[model samples]
Target: MDQQFGEQIGNNLEVYMDYLFIKSVEEDHMLRDTVDTFQQLWKIIMKLNLRKCSFRMEEGKFLWVIVIKDGFKANPEKVQAISLIPPPISLKEVQKLKARLVAINRGRDVAQNPNDTEESIWCFLCEAQLYGAAEARKQFLEVGGDPRPVMRQAYNMFKDGGDPEKLVDAFSKGRESEYFYASLYAGLYYESQNEADKAKVHIVASCNSPYGQRSDDYMASLAKVHCMCRNWEL
Candidate 1:
């Protein structure tokens, strides 16, 4: 059926199992492209369950990820689920928590200390102090491995203090393009503080960054940042 429809609609339609994605490069041509694809579907005797279908949407969930005009996003429900989990108490619980974090992060390796014991993991989860700028900077410098995670932690520290400039400067020493999530966090922090112009600059940069263009998680964050900017305008 896909081959038959592909012959008719050309490159405008994509099919996976019973799912179909009708797309067009130009917004002006989208309606016509959808209509043409549907006509082809009808000719091939393909039935669509309209209740399960969406059309002309700016964004929607597909395969558990939010698909948007610019990119894909992590599902908020999944993020919330991870956040709601109780802190690990036992070794088994810590392992479970580690597994859950890995899954939520799309299989990205969860940070683990080489010398960590089960008790240490539990303490790290339950007794970790929220750092201030000085402590965050100290951690960022001392942990000279992946700067991205350190920058994120520092950005969050600044964000909690309503300091967007500090958040920006936290990652400015490195390539800004490499820390798209930090930039987006800074943008949101600025937006929360009613700094629309500053927020706009960071949000736009985040949306267009190489990481944003390539990673689904960043894309999802971009979708949220876009919505926040739109709402601010309204």
Candidate 2:
């Protein structure tokens, strides 16, 4: 709908599914928007149910979210409903839990405020990681984040089904990166795919990362132990 009247709506509109919320600072602008929107809807042969509509209200509920001049806020009653959800027991239920988080995250648009905050975008990136690196990268970009580090790029490439050896080759053109955490991820992926030789090479490189040694991070040590247990040279 905004495609037809984007100039008119601007930031004064928010649409979700079939629901629409239109805001205007002046009474005449509100009336004009209402008339034009309704006329467009009818012209498109869509039906508007008057009984389900409210007008000229200072504040109202939209999809359980309360909207007012001060801006939108969550409906406590709906939040209480969510809190009553039972604990998940199985992997499928765990997946369900993640899906529920995605639903809860719909309360705000991460792309709307790229400069102010990114809690919502990071939350998305966390869940998207399960899907693969492409999904994760898209969420990262929505908040103006760059997915750059050599190892980070390599990990994302491998996770999205690119070959492990190809990653090392690609990043080695100008420079080489121990890629710490990212190399571990790529190594794990290679190991899972039965490419043990490729996994050992990357994991050993990860074992030598200066950042990991300085931080004394447990995962870095764990990677070393894993290589030892497998009898792979480090």
RMSD in angstroms, all models? 18.9, 8.8
State how far residue 199 of model 1 sits from its true place (Å): 52
- Give the local distance difference test score of model 1: 0.54
Candidate 1 vs. truth: CA RMSD?
18.9
The lDDT values for all models are 0.54, 0.59
The global Cα lDDT (0 to 1) of model 2 is: 0.59
Q: After superposition, how far is residue 171 of candidate 1 from its true place, in Å?
A: 49
Residue 58 in candidate 2, Cα distance off native in Å: 1.6
lDDT of 1 by residue, 138-227 (tens): 322111123355344543444235465666566656664546656676665555445768877877666776666666774456445575
Q: Output the number of the lDDT-best candidate.
A: 2
Q: How high a TM-score does candidate 2 get?
A: 0.43
TM-score of each: 0.35, 0.43
